[model samples]
Target: MQYSIGELAHRTGLTVKAVRFYSDRGLVPPSGRNAAGQRRYDDAALARLDVIRVLRDLGIDLATIRRVIEGETTVAEVAAEHVAAVEAQIGVLHRRRAVLNAVANRSQPEEASLAHQRLLLSEVERQCLIGDFLADALGDRPELAGIARTLTPELPGDPSPEQVQAWTELAALMRDTDFRANLRRLVDAHEGGLRRDLAAEVRDAVTPALVAGIGPKSPAARAIVDGLGRDPGELREWLDAVSDPRRERYLELLGVINGWAAPESMAPAFGWLAEVMAA
Candidate 1:
């Protein structure tokens, strides 16, 4: 028995227009025309429309649905493919959620979001992300390639919770414009040879004075400063740059990312030198 479009809509819980749309798309074509030249569909059309509705609800695209209906592909094949795609999307959302959670705990949601993006990069892109960052820091010296690799964070295929947290903090730090400039200043002076071992020079001079509890403006402090041979004017900028807490934080994050030992901080030496210079 043939059913009118309205009947098909009623039977399938669809609107008449929706039924007509699928029929027009050749998904459930009219079996024949009625006496008044209206479309009429047989039981076969009704069954096909039921299948179409189920597939549509499953989020299968029209082209793929067509292939399934036409026997070009199996529903099992489509289901498997869709399951993989959906699982991939879920994985990304899970990672993003984890990053956001990390941010919520840290008070820097924006930076944590940046870390999420960094984690999404392909291996080549990941390498480039770090290469470019280090290039900006180390001036892209080929001879320093081994040094650069050592500095780069190699996030494993399946990183630990600690690594993700470390990466989130590190990525955010790396993206900060001020932090980048601070890093460049420190690196250029020391590693780039603009002023070799400037920090070391200050640390050596300042540590002895610090150990003796010498005041910044004391005569003894003055003698120590003079022995360093760096004019105070020349020393101030370097001291200020080294004194940034983020510099210390950066090293700490690097250790976490690369599985290295926690680096010894020069904060005490830098702090003492800055105080003396300010005096």
Candidate 2:
């Protein structure tokens, strides 16, 4: 039996335009022309159209479809390959969804909207993102490499859900203008021959004073402050440089990304010691 374009479209449950599109692609070509020169197809074209429909519904691309049509490969081979591809895509989608869910549970980060694209970055791309951030933050001064290392967030190859969320937040923090400026100040202090970590020393000294019930303005608190070898007035400058809330939060996220234990906060100690120094 012979079928006109409209007749073939009606029988195959396709729009006339879709039927013409396949015909133009030569997936279903005309068997002959009618007397008036309208295209007519036979059962063979209809059979080919059915094959095309099934493959299209399975999400196979036309290039792959053409291979099947031209006998370059078998339908079974295509289905098997497509099945694996589909399964792999599904796994990726699930992971992406979980990462988004993790982001949603936290306070909305500054670049929360771009979190998905950031998560899609490969390891090399991820490294480049931090590298660019460090270059922008610390400049090209190679002498400051040690300080840059302390700021880098190293997300592991196989990260936990928590780690992924932490990296997302940390990446957003890296873009913060004020946070970058604060980091620059830290670099200046380090380069100005204050390579010692005054913040760490103060936090360590004040932690003991805090547990021992020594008041921040008490003589014992002053004793702990003096023990750190920092002049009473200079601790405040280090505190201002290092104790930005965002800076502390960045360190918390860094710990999560690098698989370190949650860090005890330095804020209480910094505040206490700063108060002690003032006293």
Candidate 3:
């Protein structure tokens, strides 16, 4: 028995346009033409249309449908490959959702709206971008390289929302030119070991005085500095350079990214010591 395009569409519960489209794609070509040149289909054509409908509903593309119809590939092979592609797509969507959730929780700007961020940044690209900043800031200082690696944020395959947010903020912080120059200065001071050693000495000496409420410019604070056995001039210079607020913020953001305990800011103590030197 033969059916015209309209009859085939009605029998199969598909639109006439959809049936015609399938015919154009040759997925369900008509068996023959009627006397007036209208297309007509036999039972085999109807069966092919049924298969095409099922495959299209399953998210199979028309090219793959053609391959299956031609016996060039099995339905099972195409479906399996499609399943893998769907799973990868799902993974990307989940990450994007997590990033959006994080942004919402923090009330961040809409510039990182989910679709835009997903398209712009991948985890590998994110890491590579930060790696570029680190290389530029640290130069070839061997002593600071280990610190640089430890400071690098490694996002997990399945990261928590907080990790996503932390990574976003850290990326922003690293992109600041002034932040990069400040970090380079901090690293240079650290490379010499003198700045760190001096800071440690002053902290050890003055933390007790600071805790006791001895004012920084008071005689007792000066006495504490006098006992540290370092040149007050060198210590004062280090204090002035490293007391930048951005430096403290960088550490805070680093702690968030690495899941470390927030390190206590020594800015107050350093500021007090700087005051004593000025006096």
Number of the top-ranking candidate, with lDDT as the measure:
2
Please list all clashing residue pairs in model 1, or write none if there are none: none
Evaluated at residue 26, the lDDT of candidate 3 is 82
- lDDT tens digits, residues 1-279, model 1? 999999999999999999999999999989899789999999999988998899899989999989988989998999999997777566556655655565566657676566667665555665676767787776756766775776688665445567778876777677677877876776655553437566677777787778888888788877777787765765676677778998788778888877889987889887766776777
Per-residue error for 109 in candidate 3, Å, reads 6.0
| Candidate No. with top TM-score | 3
Candidate 3: tens digits of C-alpha lDDT, residues 14-73: 999999999997889888998999999999888888878889899888999999988999
Residue 154 in candidate 1, Cα distance off native in Å: 2.1
Q: Is candidate 2 or candidate 3 better by TM-score?
A: 3
Clashes counted in candidate 1 amount to 0
Q: After superposition, how far is residue 148 of candidate 2 from its true place, in Å?
A: 2.9
Among all windows of 10 consecutive residues in model 2, the one with the lowest summed lDDT is 230-239
* lDDT tens readout by residue for model 2, 111-169: 55667667876556777889988987788998778978877887654567888888878
Candidate order, TM-score descending: 3, 2, 1
In candidate 1, position 211 carries an lDDT of: 85
Error of 2 at 237 (Å): 1.3
lDDT of 1: 0.77
* Cα TM-score of candidate 1: 0.56
* Model 3, TM vs. native: 0.61
